[model samples]
Target chain A: MKKIFKNQIALALAGILAGTSAVAGTLVINGDTSDPAPKAAFQAVIDGFEAENPDVDVVYNLFDHEGYKAAIRNFLSADAPDIAFWYAGNRMAPFVEAGLFAPIDDVWADQGLYSLMASSAPGMTMDGKKWGIPYTYYNWGVYYRQDIFEDLGISVPTNWDEFIAAGETLKANGITPITIGTKYLWTAGGVFDYLNLRTNGYDFHMALTSGDIAWTDDRVRATMANYQQLIDGGFFLENHAALSWQEALAPMANGEAAMYVMGNFAVAPLKELGLDDSSLGLFQFPAITPGVPMAEEAPTDTIHLTAGAKNVADAKRFLAYAARPDVQTAWNKALGQLPTNAGAGVTDDKFLNQAFSMLNNDAPGGVAQFYDRDTKAEMASIGMEAFQEFMVKPERLEKILERLEKARQKLY
Target chain B: MYSYWKNNQLKIAPWIFLAPGIFMFSLYVIFPIFQSINLSFYQWDGLGAKTYIGAENYIELLDDEYFIVSLKNNVIWLVLYLLAVPAGLFAALFLNQTVRGIRIYKSIFFFPFVISQVVVGLVFSWFYDPSNGLLNIILEFFGFDTIAILAEEDYVTYGIIAAGLWPQTAYCMILYLTGLNSVDPEQIEAGRIDNARGWRMLWYVILPQLKPATFIAVVVTIIGALRSFDLIDIMTGGGPWGSSRVLAYYMYEKAFSEYGFRMGYGAAIAVVLLLIMMVYIATILYRLYQDEKGS
Candidate 1:
């Protein structure tokens, strides 16, 4: 029996050694930052980091973007990985409030990320402390059909009147002026965010989304009025409500529609549908309240270090690595977005160039993360629905705004 | 231990056999259900501390427009979903005949049941797509403008129910088909002598024997209609502004979706839905008890 116990001890030691050798220093990452582009870009950085830091290994688990939202709350509070991928701004705020995320002040300071990601810093910060690293962000604008516009002799619109005129011109032609699908309902939000940002500017938009102001505010009604013009002009696709964002691209790709108010990420899918750079064009969502100073919708994607992270030191290293200008340059150049890192080099992709310039063009206010990112998910869900309903029936704007205001009262 | 087991094997073996299953059921099913009920009175965001807010969640639901909408949709689902049992009976009756290659027809008819509901939801979503879908093409061919089934608030729930019914009807048909095989030929022959044919024969002679199958069918269909989530989730996501939400989908949307995790409120919604299901289950079980007593 003593000999058997001795054998068990020997086997246990061997198992311990095996386990340690395999992954004692493995830094686990949990994310739902999804694909066609972002996942690969993230994986590349992970691979690069592991290769450079040969002492530590890495484990990556990617969940479906929507599934992760439900699961993250459980995981973050329990078996959290070293790092978790998520959105910045109000989306990160709730988690920050709950203290599920580690306050990574050291991460920002050690890497000098404060200066590097100055624009996105506020989005990830709550009560004067940083909770996550904002690695990358993309600008939202009107991606239009250049060839179709050339055919119609329409120049890119820069302000409300020109934008309306372009829409009228596109409508007068056989082509649909704008294509959108609000099936998942965030697509309408992009249009709403741009219009609100352009009309009321960032301060009011932020105030309104945060429930500091009511949806019944007249300035918001004015933004709705701008949206109504597009709806009444017969500008949008007839059955957009039935389609996903990808399905909405069918009309634009075939030149039946001329424009879409979407983000830079949509470029990859648009390219896949057989439209190249020469066929496409980029323009800022035209100014409405002409001097509102063109606040763009630029949602930053962030990575958080969990307070429950087993490998805090290694996760900090990864966060610092991700925040580095050289890493941001490589990651964003591959994904084709403007990096948050100030010193990061950018790609020569024309849309990316125009997007960078558009966001940086010394407009009075900088940028607002789009509706879903700017507000709580509950508010955003109701708001997106109201936006959809507004698109279909702008006459019900009063009722819709009243309903939204009621929800804001309840939720916030 | 070996000698003790050998001496009292019969006494210990049955419990030993049942232990794992009982352990798992209590852990996963029974425990979570009780926990959900307990959670209903407290405000807990799946991640953080739980704060007791006794009955606030239920009070909130009373005024919740989406909750009311979902409750109404559940009623519509239950009523419309009943049509599947009759439809399934008809399919089984129609295919009950002995024809050459009838096995292929059976497989084809049973195809929807074999496919996952997720796949069915996708197929139906594509089918209902206004511009690129076959349903709209057929509508256009008939010189009617297309109806965007999943997008229209009034029609969205109905569209999802139709997709759900496809698999549900197939499931019911298979159940009836098995029941039909167990149906006594002696009863059918006796009915023939009594001039009972067609509907009369099915009603009097066959269906009575198919009671066990009917019971299982109704139970499953009731459960299926209540949990008609995946189709609604995939096809519409309770949209055109939450018009398509059912109780299950609404609970999930509140608890899990990016809509925000109002766990207590979600649990309240779930408790109400569970109570509704429990009422039906109680009736069913009472009837089963009566039948067993009669036997």
Candidate 2:
């Protein structure tokens, strides 16, 4: 018995050494970050990975926002990267169904990643498998110019009536009540998602996208009516249809616009424009109607390994290394984003800290935002068009809903 | 034996010389056109297996409101884009003087065509900006309210076309400048002896010699107008309610943009765009064929 035990111990030690040496291959990573801060975060993580595994060589290919999406689609169909950053939800569904993305269920189990990631974010896992792990998440809300609000003697409204009153107050003070750029259309969807969630709650919002509820339902129509009210009340920037999200920021920064309902990503640009912490503030999109269940906007960013990866083991190791608390801390700090890992350190930026708190508290019940990742691409395109139409011509509400229903039916 | 080499060998050698270019044109251009037409009948999301949908994509397109909007905007772009040709001729005439700085003025006039369309879109976007844009600032100085040209539905298409015209007019100016250089000096002397001068000299004498340049200009302008995408994409992305979507932009939105990878639907839209373009292209080709026969 003693002789057998010694032989087993020797085999186990050899296996550990072999495993360590095996992780020494080159890893190819594709990421999207035109922003300098995010690029710095990704670079730090790559450096740390190379340092820990001295024998391993990492090749990182970075692309801008739209280019990244196109490159990933083309790469998956041909020579896929060992690992990539991709949106969760239906955006990843096409690649997943094509058998291009490797399942990371075992990694999740081994690393106890489920406990670290927000429980609600497991929605990213599909078909009884976890395919990717999230690194950072951001909350969507009304990012207002606090100085402008204070100058106008207005406070953040908590409910529907107060929200309208606030808009009225801003308009009366010669400021555009809110600023938004719908040239890409998705920015408008962010506002619509919050309105729908605050009006009909998370479950109903999911049902609406899944086609469980009719688009012409009373609750959906009510949300549309609320949006129309905002548009008609001069709550949005003039000529919003012509501007991009970046262009819209100029008006807000110049104090011509009082508020901007946007995502955490907008913070970087605001800060770049010299808006101090005291000048900027955030508040959850107010509930318009009573008795509606409310949830905060917590959009997530995930890293996935391709099923077609030539270096599967290396990719898995990279993903696991990325999820480590130390790596997450370094990445999130440089990126100015909140880490998905529970033990990750916090940033001193007040807006980022507030975003983290909002997401931590409200993510458990929140639905993913509309467009890009939540609804089917076909559905989202039509939905964004409909939303833009509704904003421009409030009288077209019925026709828009009916058209969306037709699109939804075709999708299923 | 020498006659055989001269006749048969030379004939075959010309074909051999032409083979590579013909093959490439057929493969890259002709084959893809046919393939896009075929792909239009099947529903594919690029990755998943395609479904044979017959005329379903076309039927769906008919009901699509955005498609209707895009079609209307395309017509508007086509009509408005033609104005660039005459505008370019006028500019070229104005700058054709033999003054000390004429060459510099000619180079300055040709500058817009050299820059990328993306840069043109960005520069124009800044110029039209409502808060601090050049246009708005000028309007403010003149005691008029700032106009958001890109945002208003009625003006957005015109705004984009105006940007397009800037580069297009430059292209036409270069064509005319080259044509003006090649005009027969003897013919101009004859017209001058006949008392033709200034506008009459241009109309009766110089304009007749400039037909080839005008033909090339119209052909290019028509193709450019039909294929307008970059300006719309960079300027508004077919927005304010998709009021500015030309067929090309709409086709792109359907194919690759957040619109589902409805490859079939995108192909269908492309087919429609192609058919509309074919009308103008066929006319140009037919005109060229006649010209060849005449020669």
Candidate 3:
């Protein structure tokens, strides 16, 4: 009887301890930190934070990459995490408009980190306030197989005529000049972004993606005409539509195809397939209108505070800590991408160096986030589908544009 | 109170027994249906305030070209999926013979149904892959140009339906196999004595015995056709320009995909699909009622 009474007393004491820890001030974070590198990068920052502030406990809710996209919409309405991982630009637009993400202007002011993230600020901005801080971003351009180009005696093309001629030469040698996989539909959008940026320039491309410019506009038609050149010339792989982006990489590796237009993130996987920097090459998509300054596609990933965030102070502190130059440099190094902070040091990697130059002030035209990132998600969807259809049948440009215009009218 | 309960037990007992089930059904199923109907009239982006705009979404859907294409594809799926019933019956008959290792044959025939739809979709996707896909490789061996079945917009929907039919037919075969086991042997013997054989014997004698199985197979096949989202999602994602989208997939794209959250619009699309499924459901129920009345 005495032992039973003692056990009951012990249970009550344990319950009290558990209750106290629950109220010990925790910053809940929902992140796609399941990937090893990202998890490590996040872990380092969290460790640093805890080392500094021992009073506060941190809770990290890690999810896999694709699952996080769907999970965010559902969780944001419930008891949302203090800090959430999300993309910048149009992907974050709807959430910002619905006020699911809290405005973190005060955090920026307190940390003075906004100046450090100035280049990436435009993507995270809505109206006047910054909704979040970006940590990592990567560039999108032409990823071509150099060995195939050498075999075909082709130099990197500069302008429209040279580009088409090079494609012809590659075709003569029995290689598809450009290989793409549009089964998932976003790869086609990357091609369209480059085409629009080169042909009509950045502002017009932005207008087109944002639904300000009609799909049937003369400029859009002109851009399609340029795109149609490659399509009609049979430059892309014949069975491109059947493959996903990863599956499409097989032909490039086997020398069946010469070139591909993809983001820098594709480099690691290509290297994993035993191809080096000499065998694989990165180049900007050639100019269509000779003097049109090249605006590059660099999509960014961001961290934000949810509106339902209970531990607001800790959330802001975490965002500020994440935006620190040393932290970002380490994170991006771990992540194998370019850090968003201007002062952050980048690792000595060739592709990332070129990617940095492509988006930095060295490039003539400023950064426009990729087609899908720059537009409303619905608008991007319509545009991507149209792009896929256009790639398949460029002759149906008029019809495709008309359909896209109608979707824009109804949706936006 | 106990004496009063005994006095009206006949009337009270049914309510007592049904109360929990009725309450649950109303909460989970019936309430959601009515809520969806209400949602169909509003414009909500799933996270924001809902604005009621009566029939606006439906009116927009009237002129939506994608809706029309999806409707057409759904019709294609519905028609093609019905072939499963006959195919299942044939497989059941083929495997009915008394032979060594017949159960193994039955299991092999039933294997596709045991696998999930997502895995089947993936397997079929590989089979239809243009460059090195099984189908194209065989065509190449025959000195013909390879066909990219999943890539062509005109053929994409049919390709997906063919994949869907594999598992649907397997499901029907299992049903028919069960029905065949329960068939009255005395009746079959009598039919044989009356000179009924081959097609006549099977149709007049065997098919009549499989009425219950046929009814279930037809109903399930129809439901499977309408519920064709997961395969399309795993395979094409309504792509090559949304050419292979069915109503369910289209509704999902509008409601939840990275495309955008147009919840009210999605609800409207769901309402249209519900109305279509309701017609078949109503016909089946009416037939069952008539059968009961005749009996």
Which structure among the candidates has the greatest TM-score? 3
Task: Return the TM-score for each candidate structure.
Answer: 0.92, 0.92, 0.95
What is the TM-score of each candidate's chain B when compared with the real chain B?
Answer: 0.92, 0.94, 0.97
Which candidate number maximizes lDDT? 3
Q: In candidate 2, residue A102 scores what lDDT? A: 86
Instruction: List the per-model TM-score of the A chain.
Output: 0.92, 0.91, 0.92
Candidate 2 Cα misplacement greater than 4 A, ranges: A1-24, A362-364, A367-370, B1-7, B192-201, B258-260
Question: Per-residue CA lDDT of candidate 1, range A88-194, in tens?
Answer: 88988878888888899988898887887888888988889999988888888899999989988999898889998998898888888899988888999888888
What DockQ values do the models have?
0.55, 0.38, 0.47
Candidates sorted on TM-score, descending: 3, 1, 2
Cα lDDT tens digits, model 3, A59-140, are 8777656556656777787557788899898889889998899999998787776787878888888989989989899888
True contacts kept of each: 0.80, 0.67, 0.78
Interface RMSD of 1: 9.8
Candidate 1 C-alpha lDDT tens digits along B1-295: 9999899999999999999999999999889889999999999877678999998999898988889999999999999998889899889988998999998999999999999888999999989989879999999999999999988888988999999999999999999999899888888998999999988998888989988888888988998999888788778878888889999989977886666588998999999999999989899999989999999
CAPRI-wise, candidate 3 is acceptable
Question: lDDT by residue for model 2 over B1-295, one digit each (tens)?
Answer: 8889777996789889999999999999999999999999999987779989899999988888789989999999889999989999998888877999889999999999999998999899899987779999999999999898987888999999999999999999999988888999999999999998999999989999999999999989989999998898778778777788988888777776645467788899999999998998899989999999999
Clash totals for all candidate models: 0, 3, 0
